[model samples]
Target: MNTMTLWHISGWGFAALAFAALLVGFSKTAVSGANTVSLAIFAAVLPARASTGVLLPVLIAGDVLAVLTYRRHAHWPTLWRLFPAVAAGVVVGTLFLVWADDGVVRTSIGAILLLMAGVTLWRRRRAESADGADEPDAVTSRAGRMKARSYGVLGGFTTMVANAGGPVMSMYLLSAGFRKLGFLGTSAFFFLIVNVSKVPFSAGLGLIDGRSLLLDAALAVFVVPGALFGKWAVNRINQRLFEQLVIAATVVGGVQLLLR
Candidate 1:
């Protein structure tokens, strides 16, 4: 047997990739706030641009599973506001990919993740004290539409750039009073469409090709079980605790990205 493999693929690299794939699948499909960990792990192992490209296909695979699992529970209005802004953000991110330097990319992604983490943590703390229970806030009234839009715009930009948008969008949905199924379903649809939309863009940029695609295929398999686990965990977890866990994961992920 060969002791070494191409790119050290059999060593820590594959192990890292596997772990990242597991997290990506889980975060994309269900637990929303686990994105920060996925981002850090993938970036650590792969080139930054390549990491996004390789991970997008795996994310789409997970999104497919999420859609299947949560199709009936989606809140259409939440998606309506979020998708358009997110699409616009993707356009902006594509432009950045075309022109920005590495420093710009790093700073932008780190900042966005940090901001999302901050918001998630702050809201969770307030919700804990104010409600004495973890309920989606009463932010969905007509009065809350403006607030939601504001959140949507930021979430779109962050997600488009780094796939770091989950925690951002998750906080919005939670604050807007979406409960478990509604939040999961809305996220499923949102990411499913967005990740699919990124295919041609990533290709055009040459971020994904033969090797990346093959790697994606292997990683996609993990997403199925990760997502299923997320769905099952959702059933047993307290709504408040679940939300808090996501937020905590988000904070950790965001900080790691920033520090890295």
Candidate 2:
């Protein structure tokens, strides 16, 4: 209960961590806001700085699993195109992390998430109206390019500060017209590369350390089951509905991050 005790570890807290990991798994595979919930939970259980470090490895673990599950489904062209801009955004976010107030950071992240969620919802709605039980032209292009530069930049900035990169990328893929597995797979790989790349940056920021890594090692156990379950759930659910779930969760999580 004391601050010192929290700093070490909490057994029931691991349970809390596992529950959050389950959310992370779901978010990684189904929704984009899972990180927001996991981030808040980890921050509550550990120090904010410590929590970010601790959660990063576990996320990478989940990212690996998701990438494996959906590896073949990624839209590589979109991913490749987004890389430079995303990297640029990451630098911007890392810089922002250096001096911004936590409240300001959360609010900005929340606002972006909320806005992306809204856009995704509207697009999906239109996609459904345009056609159903069949893939639309919008979601099926290989060289589809419009907002790649803009989305990539925003996605990078969001992910860096609040680990909010998932939704940013989610909206990008959604607008580009990727299917569920493709979206999940592309997101999986993109974050894998991006999140892994962040280790050094995060380290420089002192957002990662020994205690946090140990905790990540311990909590990584929960993500597999969550991913498996999400995989199954997505298979049976209607694609539109499944994405709506993710978008709705995004709005809630986004708002929470901003309001918190």
Candidate 3:
């Protein structure tokens, strides 16, 4: 498909894509896991396999904005420890993509999203039950390293397959006791690096092409306003309410994908 062919989407379809792109920016800055909704939207609108490629550039755009917004707060030690495991996961995800058909990919991503949502909910409840006790530092402990590796591999795989790494990383950071700025900062840099690295793999898979790039070009502009809005609202928004909304959206998106 050429550029013009890609423009053959209906007005409603384009609207949905634009909204999803906006959510990508919002998720990057304000809420890390919320873009799972955007993932669902893209997959529903475009071919399941191809949506991953098209959404990657948009995610990177948001990552850039996020890093710029929260660059100073990142903890480099954590990022370094996770990279090796993440690389292995990325390789595995690429291989899986090579063999999986559209139906399989769609169902797998849907299942993954729902599972992540459930995990997040469980973790949150557990933390609350523990009365938010101060846990050991995840950056320094041996156990922390083990946990990082586990989350790292999963994060890399989910991201490569479905652009759903945000939730996995969010859970890890929360478990590590990262405050808001630190979490956003580390996540921003992490995704910028990972998503950029996925470009060649996505292209090799025939998921990134002229047609997808054309659509991306049109959709990326919407991300800017969404990002700016998120930046402005981040400090003022009620954290509990915002988190609940994000999880609810994820659940809805997951159900849609599974039922579609």
> TM-score for all predictions?
0.83, 0.80, 0.93
Give the alpha carbon lDDT tens digit for every residue of 1-260 in model 2.
12233376568887989988887876677655456667666655665544555677888888988888889887776678889989999999889878875456556656766776776776667656653322312423444444677888888887777676775676566665666677777788999999998899888877776655666776788888888887777667565666666666667766666555
Off by over 4 Å in 1: 1-10, 129-145, 238-260
lDDT at 198, model 3: 94
Candidate 1 lDDT score relative to the true structure: 0.70
Q: Is candidate 2 or 3 superior in lDDT?
A: 3
Better-scoring candidate (lDDT), 1 or 3: 3
Candidate 1 lDDT, 95-184, residue by residue in tens: 878786555666566676567668777767765554332344454666567766676666656665676777667767766667667778
Which candidate leads in TM-score?
3
Ranking by lDDT: 3, 2, 1
Q: What lDDT is obtained when candidate 3 is compared to the true structure?
A: 0.85
Q: Is candidate 1 or candidate 2 better by TM-score?
A: 1
Candidate 3 off by > 4 Å:
1-8, 126-140
Q: Pick the candidate with the highest lDDT.
A: 3
Instruction: Report the error of model 2 at residue 1, Å.
Output: 22
